[model samples]
Structures are given as structure tokens and as C-alpha cells.
Target chain A: MSSLDIRNLEIHVEGKPIVKDFTLNVPKGEVHALMGPNGSGKSTLAKALAGHEDYQIVAGEASLNGQNILKMEVDEIARAGLFMAFQYPSEIPGVSIANFIRAALTARLADNEELDAARYYRRLYEKMDLLKIDRKFTARSVNEGFSGGEKKRCEILQMAMLQPHFAIMDETDSGLDIDALKIVSHGVNTMRGPDLGILLITHYQRLLDYIVPDKVHVMWDGRIVRSGGKELALELEEKGYDWVKEEVAVV
Target chain B: MPATIEQETTNHSIDFDREVGNFKYKEDYSYDAGTGLNEDTVRYISGVKDEDEWILNFRLKALKVFESKPTPTHWASKDLESIDYSKIRYYLSKGQQPSRSWDEVPDDVKETFERLGIPEQERKFLAGVEAQFDSEAAYSNMKARLAEEGVIFVGSTEGLKEHPEIFRKFFGKVIPTGDNKFSALNSAVFSGGSFIYVPPGVHVKQPLQAYFRINAENFGQFERTLIIADEGAEVTYMEGCTAPKFETTTLHSAVVELVALKGARIQYITVQNWSENVFNLVTKRGMAMEDATIKWIDCNIGSRLTMKYPGVILKGRRARGEVLSIALANNGQHQDTGAKMIHAADDTTSNIIAKSISVGQGRSTYRGLVQIPKHLKNCKNNTECDALLINTNSRTDTYPAINVRGNRNSVQHEASVSKVSTEQIFYMQQRGLSEAQAMSLAVNGFVNDLIREFPMEYSVELKRLIDLQMEGSVG
Candidate 1:
């Protein structure tokens, strides 16, 4: 069983601390929701966990299946079974979606072992179909000129294809319509199984209604202040973030 | 992120020096007209080819023209001034006629081309193949079906001697000897370029390919090519060139002229990967008649300095012209390439798309010209030049001269210079590609649109070549 374990992680951007004393763990077969207000450092934590160069880790330990991921490169971290669905997917002009995914899969293979193109395409098409993405999109450049919903769906498509041990979806619902949100949620639900863990980071609690996280945590000022079950999301939605700020102030 | 965030970095200049390989070949030249160019050299070259009197006289006149004209000094790069005419071997040949079969070729020459995969490519897709070693063609062959269809493909010397009636009329009409200094020099001692003629109403479905290799030290390769397509005919010609590395500088100057008659279409493609010590200066132009089309697809890589601008003249009503070029300049190289389009008739159209990449301390320049005179009616022209810089020390420049005087003519010119973004690199790296692979993919992506215009086999080879160039470019 694989897990993403982060303990006492302190991340800084340009020498200014953004995520301080952050600790979270999501084991396989469970989903965790990270709800935070703006400037709460939720996205910072996600990017830092993915080994973004700009997000300097001051003190932290992030392990993937007993492997120290914080010491690895960004790509190494990814190959170690951690996936981050970006808030903004980059537009790689001229690189087809098929080629991008193939490159990722090929990287995981041993040297001198080539990815079987036919099998790879079959799997890719299956995942693409599950996400309601057009089959013609396989030949299109990755996320180039794609609509907002399309970009989000593409990220989910990548997460589904990679089938990582843990996936951190950052604002996967932003810029998505109700139908797109439903499709994305369905994709996420389909990928959630005994071997995969998920951490959904969002500013709003709306996404929680669809994914139905096993645990919900409200973060304030770079640290999680409260944790509860699924009902906590609806309660926080009704009470608004001001209540969380007051609660954190009392703490 | 803002909709449009301009993140411009100040250019950081750095010095870069790369050691070029010094690979040489040991072979006997049956005929070697020693170094230096003069009337004697031109006469000797003509005598060796056993050309007609008019051809020899033409060469002698061109020799005078070459001597009179000075090396161009106003270009973006001053590498032209360094070419020493006296140090260059004017001509060398293996003293054997071009053979129709590979078995008939000299053993050493055949082995060289076999290693370069010329014969294999011909067997797979080409309708004909012409392999030139040094100054003369060592092997030339065409499919029997093509030969039976009245299509003529052979060396220029053979074409002139065997079919002068057809070859003489249009030989230098498209590109005159006095067109440029290099053209003049090429005309004086030119040898071993492909000569093709397509009959009217006949289409050659497969491409005819030519491979040129320069093997001697301090050698100068001056090949002259002429292609003519009759009315309603269509054909495509492709050329590939490479040279062995040498400590001393080598010069390659060629003149290629194409004539597309009424309703005919001709496409010319060149993929040049010369050694770093070679100076490649070429003059290529095409003339399109009524309702005809001419297209030039040129790719330039390697070579210490290259200045080539393939152009077309739309001389008849409703004629069309296009030039698609991709130039890559690695360390210590300069790729100065672009296109020229001349609209001389009403309803003529032309298009130019040029993409260039500069790696390390290399420099690439887009120098182009488009002219639509005042009397031309309903003429249209579009030109786009894009440059990608791969390093902090790399540089690029654009110089486009668009002259549009006609009121009804439509002209559009667009040029862009962009450096490979760090975000792009990081994004690709996140997908598990190494820095070199990411760089290669991004560079390939930048020119992907234009590369699609190439034939399938060429596009694949071009990508492989770019990948090799980008392997060690990033630290």
C-alpha cells in the first residue's frame, strides 16, 4: 500500500514563508479535501510537494511509499507515483497529447524497453473516452487553444492515464461548468480505488459535494486549524470563511 | 495570470567556443585540377567535361565576371571576406562516367553513399537518385518506367551533351551567371548537379533525390542544377549534402534554376548538413509561367556560415510561388537564409514562411525581399519569419524588404523572435523528459508547422537531426 506522508512541512517563496508547519497524510483508498481561503498557502503546499523550483522547502519531509520524495527531482517525484493536476496546464505547442503521455509512460520503462504503441494508444483512448474527451484530441497539441473546461478535463485525463499512487488536484473545478464539473468528478471517482489516494485542494466547498471526500480540513494562515468528516464541508460552506478565521484567531 | 504577461529577460552575452571534428578521407582523384581559380581553371574544368565550344566560352566569360566582382561585404556576417580563392581546389573527379547501377560505382564512393543511406532511400521511395562525390557524379539512375515516360534525369554534363536541344535553351535563363558573385564562380567551374526535365502533361509521383558529398581538403564544390517542367507537368526534386570535417576551410557554391512552364508545378527541396569548416553560399531561383507554381523547401543545418535565399519570379498571369525554410545554427555557425518573391504579372500570388533556431553562440538572420511593382493588378504576397533562440548567448535578426506599389495588391509581413521559455522546459520536465529531450521537443515544436510541409521521409530525418543537435546544447 502506497501513501503520501507530509510532516511539519515549511515551504517558502523567495525567502518568505507561505506554508508553515503543514502536516497531512493521505493513504491509498482514501480521499482528503483541503479547503482554504485565499492566501492560506494551500496551492503553495501543493506546488511545493510537487518539487516546484520556486517553492523552496525550508523544513519538510514528503515521502511516497517510503521513498523520500522531497529529495528527488520534479520528474523523479512524478515517477515515484505522485501526480499534481495543475491549476493551469501549460500549452505545449506542437506536442500532441498522445506524444506527451507516451513520453511520460516511456520514462517509466527500463532502458532499452520501448513502449508498445498499440497498447499505449488503446489505454490512452480508453481513458480519454472515460473523460468524454474527443478521440481527435489525441493528435492535437497538449492544451493548446483549449477551453477552460477542456484544460481541466485534460488534466484529469493525464491523472487517469498516469494512475499515480497519490494525486493532488489543485482547483480542478475552477472555470468548469456544471456539466464539465460532473464529467471531471466522474473521472476522479472512477480513478479512486484501493491503490490510489487523492488530495483535492479548492477555495470553495462546491467540489466536495461531487467527489465526497472522506476527510475535510479547513486551513487558515498556512496551517490546518480544523478537521472533520464530509458534513464539515457543508457546514463551512454555510458558515463562510470568516467563521474559520474567527475560530483560528481563538486557537 | 494576466491575459498577456510580457516576461522579457535582458540578453546576457556569453562567449562560446566549440571544437569541430577533423575527419578526413584518403582516396585517389583520377582528375584533380589543383587549387586556385582563374581562366585556366575554368578552361581545364570545361576540357575535363569535354563540353561544347559555346559552353566553354560561357565558362570563360563567367570566369571574367567572377574575377571582376568583389566578395559581398554588406551582409550581416563578415565570414565572406575570409574565403581565399587561391587556396580552394577548383575541381576533382573520379574519371568515371555516372553508372546506372550501384555495382558499377567505384567501391570507396559506393561505400560512402551506402553509409549515408542514399541507396536505401532511393530503393524505398525515390524515382531516381544522383550521388555526386566531390566535383562529379559517381552514380546516377532512374526507374525504367520513368525513363520510358520521356522523363530525363541525369548529370548536367550528360544532359547538356546528350540532349542539348532541350537543355541549352533553359540552362542559365532563370539564374544568370552575373546574378551574384557566388553564382558567377559556380558558373565558371560548375559540375555534377542534377538535371531533370518533365514532359508536358506527365506527373512524376515520386521525388527525385540527389546526394552531394565533398571529400577533399580545401575543396570548393560548385554544382549547377537546372530543372524544367512543361505545361501541366508536376514533379518534386530533393537534394541532400554533407562534407567530411577538415581543419582547412571548404567552400560550397551552387546555382540552381527552375522553370515551371504554363500550368506546371515544381517543388525543390534541399537538406544541407555541411561540416563546420565549410562556407555554403548558394544561389537558387525559379521562374513560373502562366498559371504555374514553384515551391522551394530548404533546410539548413551545420556549416560554419551559410547565406542562401531561394527566390521565385511569378512572371505570368495567376502564377504562384512559395518558399518554406528551416535553419538551425549551432555553436560557431551562422545561418543567413530567407526568401525572395517577385510578382511581375497580374493575379500572381506568393508566400514565404521561414523559421530559424539559434543555439549556443550561433546567430541566425532572416534576410528577405518581396517586390510587387506598381502595374501589377490583384497581386498578393505573404511573408512570415520566426526565430527561436535557445541560449542566452544566441542571437537572431530579421531584415525584410517588402516593396508593394500597386494599389490593388495585398501584402502581409510578419516576423517574431522568441526564446524557449523556462516554463515550457519545466513543464516538459515534469512529464519525465530530460532537459535535452525537452529542448529538442520544444525546438521541433516551434518549426512543426513548417516541417509538415516537407515530405514524410524528410520530415522524419529532419527531426532526428535536430534531436542530435539539441542533445548537448543544454547544461
Candidate 2:
């Protein structure tokens, strides 16, 4: 079993601290929902975890399965079973989705071992079918000219194919309509198993309604101030983030 | 470095102004034809090659045609009077045979090719690579698997010697020596360009590459290349050229002929980044048989004056031809390149797309031609030429001639010339990418359609090339 541990991590953007003393741990077979208001350092945490160059880790440790992920390159961190579904993924022109995934898979192969093309296509088709993606999506350039729903579906498709041990999905439902939300939720739900741990970071509880979480944590400022059962998401949805902001201020 | 080597090389031609001047080649490789144009120079060149009596007479005959043929006075900035044929070294070889193994090469020439990443590429990605230094191929390599498939890759000289029958049949069929003055020059002294032959039904998945390096100044490096794809065969050939910067100019004239047999497909890609003091004039043309396809992808980045037009003759029904060109001309450079397509049979299709980037007093021109006979039916031709000027002093011109005698032929020509506006730069800078990166991206986007046709590895290299060229380009 694999787990991700973020302990006392401080992240800075442009030399200004954004995520201060933030700590979160998700063990294997757990779903953790991070609920935060806008500008509450939610995206900063996601960027920091994904090793984005802009987000500098000034202090603290981020590890995956006892391996120091901060020491790894972005691609290495990805191949090491840490998947971050970007809020705004880059559109690499002239590189199709199939090629991108093929490159990622090829990078994981041993020096002498060759990728089984037949097996790769079979698995890719199966994952695409599960995610309700058109087979033609493989030939399309990554994220180029994709709609909001298509981008979200593409993200989920990548998540499904890569089969990471832990996934940090940042606002997967943002800009997604109801149908897209259902499709995306279905994709995430299909991947849920004892071998997978999910950290779903979202602004609204609507996505939580579809892919019910195991735990909910409300983030205020740069830290998670409150933690509760699944009922916490419902409470926050009804009361809204303003209540959390006031509650954190009183504390 | 050494006196004899330096003197024999004639390393410096010095400043002779804009006019091509008299500078005799001191190299022993040159066969003297005396002071004026005569039968002796032609006879001397033919005797050096030990050509067939018929070929020697053909050279003698071509000399008359060369004397009678008029210079291309219609083309802009073509001062043919400046080129002094007597001064140039027609051919020079340092006695190095094209070696299949790197260890067999001479140390100095081997070091030159090694610095340019020749043998290393052969070991990694290239299925076969021919490295030509000056006038002779120094090294050649082909993977064992490709050799077993009966795909022949060798120097043109070896092709002439080993495969005489095949070489004799198609030597000058597509672009004869009398086609142009440069072609005539190349025919007179051509030495070591790649010769490729793909066997019937064989598809070479990896591209066979050739790298030509010119290290001697005032010396003319004329290489001849011939690639034939047999019936139902498919192959891709890539060629790259580079030279060192010199105060004196060097000359490089090459002739490349390709034949795609019935139902065959051939793709020829050239990325020429010659030094800013080389006159790169090359003639490349191909012939396509019934249902065959031929493509030429040429990218010219740097040269003092480069005039190359890779053309195709669709001689059989349902044949197809395509040319995608990207020319980037910087200061003191003039890149004049385009394509030509001739449809002789019914239902032939051709497409020509050329993009040019000019910066800092550079001049680039696209001169293209497409012709369809009166009897041919349903011939289609689409030509698009675009130019991007990076500065006020930079200039670009487009001259496209489409002659479709048949009523059924459909031809389209579109052209646009635009300068990189400061507003776009400001807008892109507001985003993350820098000015150079933005310019590079824009230039890449202009040719993105053509770039998509390249393999992934080549596309990356092409992007990096554009980025390197865009550095310090912003005003």
C-alpha cells in the first residue's frame, strides 16, 4: 500500500508565502475531500504537490510511500505514482493524446524492455470506454480545442490509464456542467478501490454529492482547520464558505 | 594549421565585393580546363571520373548547352555575371573512402564529423547515415537489420561503381545536367551524396539521413544523390548541410533525383543551415509513377545566398506530389526556394506550401510553378505562400505561375505577407512566454501544419532551431 504525507509544508509563489504550515496525509484506501474558499491556498497546495516550478517549497516535506517526492523532477514525481489532475493543464501542440500517454508509459519502461503496443492500445481503449471517451480522442492533440467537459474527461481518462496509487484532483468539477459532472464522477467512482487514495480538492460540495467522500476537511487561510465525517461536506454546502471564514476568524 | 594543407585548400578567397571574382583553386583535385571555357575542361572532368566515352561526349555536348543557355535574368537579385566558373574548385577529395565503420575514418575528418553529431546519431536514431566532408563521403553506416532488408545506402560514387546498370539508367533522367548552370556544375564534379534504393515491398520505418559538411573555403562541394523506391516500397530520406563561417565565400551545388515506382511512396526532408558565407545552389527533382506519392520537406535557415527549388513530375495517373518549405533568412542572407509540379497524366494532385521568415536586411522569395497539360483531366493544384518580416529592412517576394490548360484542372494560389506587430509582442509578453519565445511560437505556429508531418523527434529539433534563431531577434 502507498500513502502521501505532506507535513508542515510551506509553499511560496514569487517569494511570497501562500501555503504556510500546511499538513495533510492520505493513507491507502482513503478518500479525503479538501473544501476551501477561493484564494485560500488550495491551488497553491496542489501546485506544490505536483512540483510546479512556480510553487517553491520553502520548508517542510512531501513524500510518497516514504520516498521524498520534493527531490524528484516533475516527470519523475509523476512516474513515481503521484498523479495531480491539473486545474488548467497545458496544451502541448502537435502532440496527440495517444502520443503523450505513450511517451509517459514508455518513460516508465526499463532500458531494455519495449512497450507492448498491442497491449497498450487494448488497455487505452478499455480505459477510454470506462470514462465514456470517444476512441477518436486518442488522435486529438492534448487539450487543444477541447471544451470544458472534454478537458475534464481527458483529465479523467489520463487518471484512469496511468492508474496512479494516489491522485490529487484540483477542482475537477469547475466549469463542468451537470452531464460533465456526472461523467467525471462516474470515471472517478470506477477507479475507487482499496489500492487507490484520492484527495479531491473542490470549492463546492456538488461534486462530493456524486462521488461521496470518506472524509471532509474545511481549509481556512493556509491550513485545514476543521475535519469531520461525510456530513461535513453537506453542512458546508448548506451554510456556505462564509460560515467557515467566520468560524475560523472566531478561532 | 599545416602549410601544405592550407595552401592546397585555398582557405581564403578574401573580399571580392558583391561580384563573383577570379580565384583559382589551388587544390590538386581540380582538373584544369585552361583559362577559358573549352572542350578540355569538360574532357578533363570526364577523364577524372573515368566516365564512359558516351558520358564524356555527353559532358562535352552539355558544355555547349551550358554556353548557350541564358542566365535566369527574370529572377530578382540573380546577378549571374558575378559567378566565375573558372575560379571555383570543381572537385576535391582527401582520399578517404566512405567507411562503414567510424574507426576506419581518418582522424581529422572524423573529428570534424564527430563535432557535428554524425556517428552518434547513427548509433542512436538513424538507421543509416552518410557523412560527407568537402567533396567525399568520410563515413557511412546502416544497421544490420536494414541491410538484411536489401535497402542499399551508400555514397553516390560507390553507387556508380557497384550498381552501374541502375546508376546509368536514372543518372540524369529527372533533372539533366543541362537543366541549370548549377546542375551542370554538379554534374561535372559531383562526388559523394547519398544513394538509396528501397527494395520492392520494403518499407523503411526509420529515416535514412546524410550530413554534408564543407570545411574548405573557395572550394565547391558538389554532391549527387539518387533515391529510388521500388514498386510498393515506402521510405523517408533526410539530409542536413552545414559549413563554417569564413570571410571568403564557399560554393555548394548538389543534384538530388528521386524516383517513386508504381504504387510507391517517398519522402525527402532537407534541413539546410549553411554558414552565412556559402552559396548553396541545389537542384532536386523526383518522378512519380502510377498511384505513387512523392513529398519534399525543405527547411532553409542560414546561407549567404541559397537558391533551391525541389520539384516533382507526376508522370502517371493518380500520382501525387507535395512540397512543404520553411525558409528563415537572417542578416546578409538571401533564401530563394519553392517548388514545381508537372502533371502529365489524368487525376494527378499536387500541393505546395512555402513559408519564409526574414529578419535584419534579409531577403526571401518564393518562386513556384505548376503546369497541367491540355489533355489531362481532373488535375488539382493548391499552392499557398506566406512570408513574415521581422524588421523594416527585411523583404520578401512571391511569384507563383500556374498554367492549367485543361478545363477540369483546379488550381488555387494564396499568399500573405505580414510583419510581427509590436502589439502582438506586447500581448504575448503579458502572458508567460518571453518575446523570443513568443516569436518562436508564432513562427512555429505559422508552419505548424507542415511541422505536424515530421516525426516527433524532428519536430522537437525544429522547434529548438526556431527558438535558437529567434534569440536577440526582438527589437
Candidate 3:
């Protein structure tokens, strides 16, 4: 299928179950918001999908556009058109943002192909403009001493530059202020189209108001407990997460 | 200028700075000092130059010092003992007096430089071929202009014979023979380096590049270089260090001395990438007079064991000194390098920034010494050394000796040893770089600021070496 299909994904961290029986399908041209409370394994699922070493994929299958991503290395999965915008983007002190993004783009090219430095810088500046980042930011070290909102916007900038088939934004809106959230959401919204799918994992309904996901799924205890349309986010936000826990208890 | 964003001034300039270079040519020498170190070896070398009695006496005294001092083992790796001083061929040459013009250079040597992809102007001086690239008219114009300005730039042998008034004054004075055992050895049998003298009050705009390449196998080992900047003059010099890969050549020890006179400035840069199995133990130091400045930017890669610590002695009031260096050690290699700043004058200042990366089973050590003695006033020193380890077995060590005992003197020394953070690599990989690429990026970032100080050509080579080393180590 032309989609990000993760089936029966079981993940563990340090031999402890973190994500269990996690199944989700985000097809092309769709934006799915995975909402969950703290410690509900939302970030772990994203890390495992991104092939992080610490997040062990004990038993599972994850595919991006019919390509088995679970069998790929972190970079290979990324090259397979799966993008992960980390909640805390690493502060690589000496690597410039422009060079980092260019490397990522270069890795996607076939052998003997070179990335045009001028064109790469031009495209990078455009993304930075879209994210309200300064042109000087490209020369600055990646996320070095960046404020919270700037880090989120930088993550969005990278997502826009890579233009992957599927992107998992893990709590991208967590640290952002209102203005930054608006800019970052605008950048993401500009990328939303028939060719792209997104799994926006977040805790608040604040971000939903800006981007408005096509589908909303509430995760509890390492699994998706409820799935519904866009209104589900508002309902959950209004009733609070304790409401879902008590309902699960009653069930 | 930082030279960080300097656009390449020429296209083909960096093509030669690519790898632990493998290009070689057949060896045909007419003059051979044979293998080994002895009084006769020293005598033979002095006789080859047909030097004065004083010079011969200097060599004889240095020979005694070289034999008297034991191998440095207190702080050096045990690998220092493996070099059989006798087995190393002391000298080899084609027996041709270096023609005063590039056109007179041997055809084979020219062809070798051409095959090595050496640029035209670089090739001429690299072979001690007299810096004449007639085909490159613009370079000739610069050379003529420099000559008109009374600047003296020539091979060391030519400088000593023709302009002894200037060359002899500062020779062996900045770094004496007893400085180290290797220095003593180089003092006895030195060859194949440059002598540059900038006149008073003149500013050389472009950097002067001179080569003491171990290009021909066993052709040159102990190279001696000296540069003198007179009052209020300034110059920048680049020493290109390269060796054709082979099994025979093993030892390379060079002694370089720089003198920046009153109110002058001198910047010396060296980018050395020797072939495998080469032991590059070099002694380089500069002396700064009143209100003068001396800066050394060094980058070391590709040798089996490199122990180089470029130093400066600030002897004049208000003098300044700096050493910015980067070293990369790959598998089966050890890069033991650092810097030393000795402030002997009042109100002098110095800054030392050193960064190194160790890949696979390689090891890097930063051994620095900053001495502001008990009597200097208002002297300040800042030393920052950072190391990055690429693999689990990769190693790095920092041994800094900062002695600032005097009143009104300040010294700051900061050292950090870090491994390439797995999270950082993962983050980079998640965006799509291979593990090796990711690791190399982390390393480049670690040494980014220092690389900026290197000339664009050397920085490009430095980055390529890092990438190649990472590719081999990370799978």
C-alpha cells in the first residue's frame, strides 16, 4: 500500500515493554494525530519506527510505501522516505544547519551524484524563510544554544527540506510558544499534500487547532485506545486524559 | 580574515591534497649518505653542502648532543624506541645543484609533480626548482614584485650561500641544537626547506607556499626552515608536507625556526599528510620581539606516529603568540601533538587552541606547556584543547602543564575529552546520513572552529581525510 503501515509493533527499552501491539496505518494524503498522556509510549513508538538502537523492535513490521523499514538502518529508513522530527533536536555544535541538511539530501542521491551547493543553500534559505528563521541561522551550528521555539521551528525546517513521504513529529509542539507554533504549523501545512503522510504525536489540543489533523488517535498503555475524526481531539482535550483512564477502568 | 568562507582562489589547487597520497616515481640518486647516523654521516652531509668551518663545527656539536641524549621515553609512547636510527637512509639526492630556475629542474621530477597533480606554481618550489613558473605569468609578476620590494624568498641552501648577512643572523638562534634529540639530529643533517626574509615595513599580501615534501622516496628527511620578518613587516607562509607512499621511507624530522622582529607579524601554516608507517617527529618554534606577533596553524594527518608541538617564546614586551592545530589519527596510528607558549616578557599574551579526533583503534594525546615565569607582569595565556573519540576502542588523552606563578599574570587552560555522542549520530542518521557520514560530521563539528583557521586548501584536505578515515572505520 502507498502508506506508512506499522502492524503489531512490539517495542522494548532495556528489556521492558514500552510499545505493545501498536498498529497504525497513515496512508498517503493523510495527517494522523497520535495523542497520548505522559509515559504512554508515544515517543518510544516514533523512535522505534525511526530505528533507534535503544528502542528495540522485538517483534513488528513497519513499512513505508511497501518498503520494509523495520529491516533498514536508521539512515536507510530515513532514505526510504521516513522522517522523524525529534522532540529534542540534538545540538551538534560544529555542523552548520546548511551542511547538515545538505548531507541528508546528498545521502538520498544515487552514487556519483553531487549536491549543488548553491542550489542547496538557496532551497535551505527558502525553508528558513518559511519557518521565520534568519538567513544567518544556516551558518550557525545546528540547534546550538537555540531556544525551545527555535528548536521546534528548526525541526520543521528540516522536515520541509527533506520532504519525506511520511514524517513522525514527536511532540514538535511541546516546547513552542504560540508564535513559533504558528510559524512551524504554517511550514508543515505548506508541506501537506497528496504525496505526504504525517503522524503528529502531541499531548495538547493547542496544536490541533492550528493544523487540524485528518484523523485523531488517543494512545493508552502502549496501544491505541480510541480512534476518531478531528473532533475527537477537542473532546479529549475538554474531558481530559483522566476521563479516558476511568472509562478504560470501567471497561 | 578567518579564511573560513574563502572561496577557492584556484580550481585545481586542492586536487593534490586528497588522501594518504599513493603516487610515486622511481628512485635514481647520485649522492647517497648511506643508511645510519654517525659522525661520518654528519661530515658527509656537511661536505655535500661544502659548508664553512663554523657550520661544520655546529653540526659536530649537534651530533654529540644527538648521541648523548637518550630517546624520549618519559612521556612518549614506546613506539619511539622502534625507529632503528641506523637503518634509516640519512640522505639521498640526484647530485644536481638545484638550478636557480624551474626550467633547469630535472625532467623526471617535473613529470612526477605533474603526475601527482601538483599545481604549476606549487610544483616549481616544491622540488626546490627555484619558484619559477614561467607559464604562470601572474605568479612570476608577484615574484618580481616581491623581489623589487627587497623581500628574500629562496631555498635554504641558496639563502645561506648568497644572503648570509640575513640568513645567518637568525639561523640556529631561535631553536638551538640542544632543544631536543630530534632537533639535534636535524641540526646535523638538514636539507630541503626554505628561507624567507621580509624587509622592514613591507606587507606581503598573498600567502607564500613552500614545500619540503618527502616527495621522492628517501630524498629528504631532516628538513630545516627559517623565516625572519624585520621591524614592522608581515608575512604568511604555508609548508606543504606530503610523501609518496612506499615501504622504504620511514622517518621525517624537521626543525623550523621563525623570528618576528620588533612590531612585525608572522603567520606560519603547515598541513602535513605523510604516507603510512612514517614517523613524523618535528620541532618548530618561533621567537617574537617587542610588539610582534607569531601565529602557527598546523594540521596533521596520515602518518603512523606524529609528535609535533609547535611552540613560541614571547621575548619582547607586549608580544603575542598563537597556535591553532588539529590532528586526526586513524587505525594503527598515534597522533601525539600539542603546543607550548613561554611568556618571558611583560604584558605578553598567547592563545592555544588544539582539537583532535581518534578513529578505530587510534589514539590522540594533547600535551601542552604554558609557562609564565615568576617575574613577568601582566602576561596572560589561554589554552583550549578538545578531543573527540569516534569508536569504542578509540582513545584520547590531554596532559596540559600550565605554570603561571608570577604576580599579575593570568592563565586559563580548558581541556575536554568526548566521544561522538550516539544520540547526536542517531539524530543525524535519522535525517539521512550513513553511520560513517554521521560520525564524520560530528567530528568536523567538533573541530570546526579550528579548521576555520586553516587555509581553505588545507581545510578541504583535512575534511576529506576525516571522511575517508570515518568510512573505513564505521563500515
Top model number, DockQ:
3
What's the iRMSD of model 2? 12.9
Give the per-residue lDDT of model 1 (tens digit) for B287-321: 99999999999999899999999999999999999
* Poorly placed runs, candidate 2 (over 4 Å): A1-251, B1-45
Error of 2 at A155 (Å): 19
What is the C-alpha lDDT profile of model 2 across A94-199, one tens digit per residue?
4567755665665567779766666777888888888788888887777779988888888888888778888999999998999889989998998999989999
Q: Model 3, range B309-332, lDDT digits (tens) per residue?
A: 999999999999999999899898
**Regions of candidate 3 where Cα sits further than 4 Å from its true position:** A242-251, B1-17, B99-104, B120-142, B215-220, B245-249
Superposing every Cα of model 3 onto the true structure, what RMSD results?
Answer: 3.6
At residue B167, give the lDDT of candidate 2: 79
Q: Could you give the candidate ranking by DockQ, starting with the highest? A: 3, 1, 2
Tell me the spans in candidate 1 whose CA falls farther than 4 Å from its real position.
B1-24
Error of 3 at A158 (Å): 0.8
Q: Is candidate 2 or candidate 3 better by TM-score?
A: 3
Q: Tell me the deviation in Å of residue B31 in model 3.
A: 1.4
Candidate 2 local lDDT, B128-172, one digit each (tens): 899887777888888889889989999987887778788788889
Assess every candidate by TM-score.
0.92, 0.63, 0.92
Candidate structures ordered by lDDT, highest first: 1, 3, 2
lDDT of 3 at B236: 88
Local error of candidate 1 at residue B437 (angstroms): 2.3
